[model samples]
Target: MNFNREDMNIVIVGHVDHGKSTIIGRLLADTNSLPEGKLEQVKERCRRNSKPFEYAFLLDALKDEQEQGITIDAARCFFKTEKRDYIIIDAPGHIEFLKNMVTGASRAEVALLVIDAEEGIKENSKRHGYLLSMLGIKNVVVLINKMDLVNYDEKVFENITKEYTEFLNKIDVEPKCFIPVSGFFGENIVDPSNKMSWYKGQSVLEVLDSFEKEKLPDDKPFRMPVQAVYKFTRDGDNRRIVAGTIETGRVKVGDEVIFYPSGKKSTVKSIEVFNGEARESIGSGYAAGFTLNEQIYIKRGEMAAISGDIKPKVTNRIKVNLFWLGRSPMVKEKEYILKVGTSKVEVKIEEITKVIDASNLNNEVKQQIDRHEVAECILKTDKPIAFDLSHEIAQTSRFVIVDKYEIAGGGIILKELEDEENKAHKENYKWEKSYITLEERAEKFGQKPALICITGKENTRKKAIARALERKLFSDGRRVYFLGINNTLYAEDHNKKEHIKRLSEVSNIMMDSGSILIATASELNRDDIETMEAAVNSKEVIKVWVGENEISEIDEDLFVSKEDTVELAVDKIKSLLQKKNIIFKPF
Candidate 1:
């Protein structure tokens, strides 16, 4: 069904008991949008049970009680004005139902966040605002609901608006407007209320009508994350259809498409659909599937894009602006599943840059993000996934974190970061072979080549420990070298991230040359360790913590203390090397 006016999907959100359902019921009733006798049937049931009538009852338990405003689920109803038609999504407001709320609001183009004038801004009020921003729903209108409870006072509305507006601004969400309304009394709902003469602006119906329909992003680069590959060969059609909704730009027959992170290319052979006209093209916002000329082994979680236009970035590391809703604190090292469009990746928190309290916009430096806290952090995925930056493509860049089968957090991809696992170094596999192999080199050196990284906080003697071990090995006539921070940073590419990569690369070369390389970096963390390991090999890399490190992210192969004697530290390191078969005991 099509409407002459713009069609919109709007989610009504706020805290529990904040009158979201009441406003939805009032809008449907006021606009005469409900089905025939649906409203009366509900009222009659209420009358039969001798219960008070509630507008919220129309929404929850559609076949059951009318008072069930919240069944802890997101439910949709239809309503329309002369200007536009709406699919009003009633998102659950209870804190336990956050996942349901995200499911409803994630697809909404606009949101109406209700607040109780008497209760003021509550916890979920600020939280929902934060979510809308992260979900890329910038078109929001705040409703200071239940003005009748506060006697339709203008000052009360103004005060609540000021406080809530300030909170939204902290999360970088500027609401479109604030409206005062009593959903129960129908004040400023469909029609402006004479009781609220001071509210001279548009009514709720007017604002709903005035909101510009969310336009499809047809002009941007074409991106459709591969949701599935279908081979319906049994139905006399032998086409493999690659399916997903186009997040941006358009696609036409014969267009050259590239499946990314893999960088494989294919051409669109035909537009496949259940039943439609002989369509030659499709654009963004359509759930389109296409048959490729050549069936490449592409799978879900890889994005399909049009070649020669803008391309999606392929990387395993990204910096995100995220909100945590997990019952447990979002601690580093805990693996979580991140879903962006059709891509699902195993991800771990690499760093917590900053955690912001949504209620007061207070920024704190914390190692973990607790439930309902917002944070800026870096994430390292198990593999690369294709994506555009959040600011560039809102639909494809936003993602949710799933912890234990529940959406524990949601965030937007702010930036792509360089990872040690990038394919740039994969070219080394093409190098010419040497007759004297790694095993021969190890036999000549009398020890297996390994990269030992000593990491600790500043003034913790990490470098001292690394130098001591290198000296002990050198004294024993073993091939060993120590590279400190200044050794790697003495030249160009001295940034923290680049330095880590360079250190790992240099260590890999030295190890290949039959010399054990001991490196020391005070700023090293788990991501750096992973990068170092990826550069060389995990089994060939040994991590030793020199002092107190609070994070549980990295599992060190060995631990030393500042109080341990240098000779004792060296002895312990040699013992571990022997245990790992990196070295053999000598007479």
Candidate 2:
């Protein structure tokens, strides 16, 4: 199998009943690309059914599609031109199968957005245009199809051209050319149309032949996300291969490669290929594997990049421009899976900054994102994932959100959030404790070591309640200590966050001695609790709140009124501790 010409993937997209399939059928018929009896077989079936043979019906092989007269899924047709071989992908134009259209368009290098000249621009016409821009397709050619319905009027062509151009321009897209044609009559498709004598431009075939090949990212920084790590030690051959498709640039043998997030470094020992000649290097668009010189601890989710100045950003939080296609609205509370490159992580919508309607580009202020709505939001993943900015490196930046194992949304990273990881909080610091195990100490003390947090608004008697709880627990023969705010923590530490951190650290020290540490804080939200949780270095913090229900983000184990007596609050805390087996029951 030898090929002299390059392969060009061209996708035809538009609204329903706009003659997209008809145009494709016509292109096949005129170019002599169809199989010997493909057209005749379709025509014979139509004749047997006592139906008229239409160009649109030629591509609709399914009985349902034949009856409905619309394309349901993306259909591929292979044909060759003098310059190159083309794979014409006919994408469905209906709104219901937008995902199918996206799948088709994402694979194409060139697009032909078809429109009905008589019907003019419709809702999907604008939506598909917006999607094309978002899908990163730069080479677009608009076809004002069905000119015969409009009596081949040049004015009709001009009007659609003017209207669609304005819409496309708003989204920063400038089409390469707009051609007037009738797919049914084969006007300006394969041959120059005599009906529209006033128009002079390249025909459909000419424009397609003139289309340039998609540029590979060979000159960019080398980045290959590790898709899988294979160890085929079954045949006494021990070669741990890191497999992935090169997203950009090239990777050669002996190139120093660095894995992100974990910051593991290794050198490429060899380029591994199956049943292929020995290759020195593999460039972008090649799914190649590498055998590292050193067996460093590398994972599938990490990206392999050439160690240099150009590198992907390592962050857990990111700001993105995303489109929601899920049946349910994208809310901040729910967790979704975000897949970028080869990395997949559990993510949540941290914040919704803005929402825009794809049809009209209207800005909407909403907390939740509904289906087909585009939103700018901050998404936080459970762990750090490496990626590039959309504008800087598109291949590594674009991602998709999966809800319930289905791809529900797609997004591009706009900015990386660095503040989340900026607070080191003594990364290398470890607590110095007595040789005796904390669990052993707890057993000896007849109580479990726990950090009991009593939180509420200011002047809610939280400190008094904490002190009472400590006294009650101590009287019950359990070693407990009370740590109040506004004493040594907040006053000595100028920063409020630092004060809360110090309080947590001090509470941890008390718990290390198998003592129940009662601490009082004001207005603790989820993030604050997380900070304390991290500082304490344990999941022993039992949350209890006083006063009105002000914090909705966190679920407290118990809520007590500020008017409650300190003794009653202490009794309630004791009962909760007993229920969790944190304290021993009296015999």
Top lDDT model: 1
TM-score for predicted model 1 compared with the true structure: 0.71
lDDT of 2 at 246: 87
The collision pairs in model 2 are none
Query: What is the TM-score of candidate 2?
Result: 0.70
Stretches > 4 Å off in candidate 1 = 1-5, 61-77, 94-106, 423-587
lDDT of each: 0.80, 0.79
Per-model TM-score versus the true fold: 0.71, 0.70
Local accuracy of candidate 1 as per-residue lDDT tens digits, 1-587: 24356778888888889898899888877887766687898899899999999887776545353355534112334677777678765457433334433322337878899999999999888878878877778789999999999999999999998888777877789888999999998899999889989888989889888878777889999999888878776869777789987878999999999988766688998886557754689988788799889766567777989989988887899999888888889888889999877888899999999998866668899999988898999999987788889888877777788999978887788999997555555444455646778999887878898988877778877877788888888988889899986777756565787788778778877777878888888856656775676667677888787776433235578878777887788898989998997877877
How well does candidate 2 score on lDDT at residue 383?
Answer: 67
Candidate 2 wrong stretches, greater than 4 Å: 62-77, 93-106, 419-587
Whole-model lDDT for model 2 versus the true structure? 0.79
lDDT of 1 at 493: 60
Top TM-score hit:
1
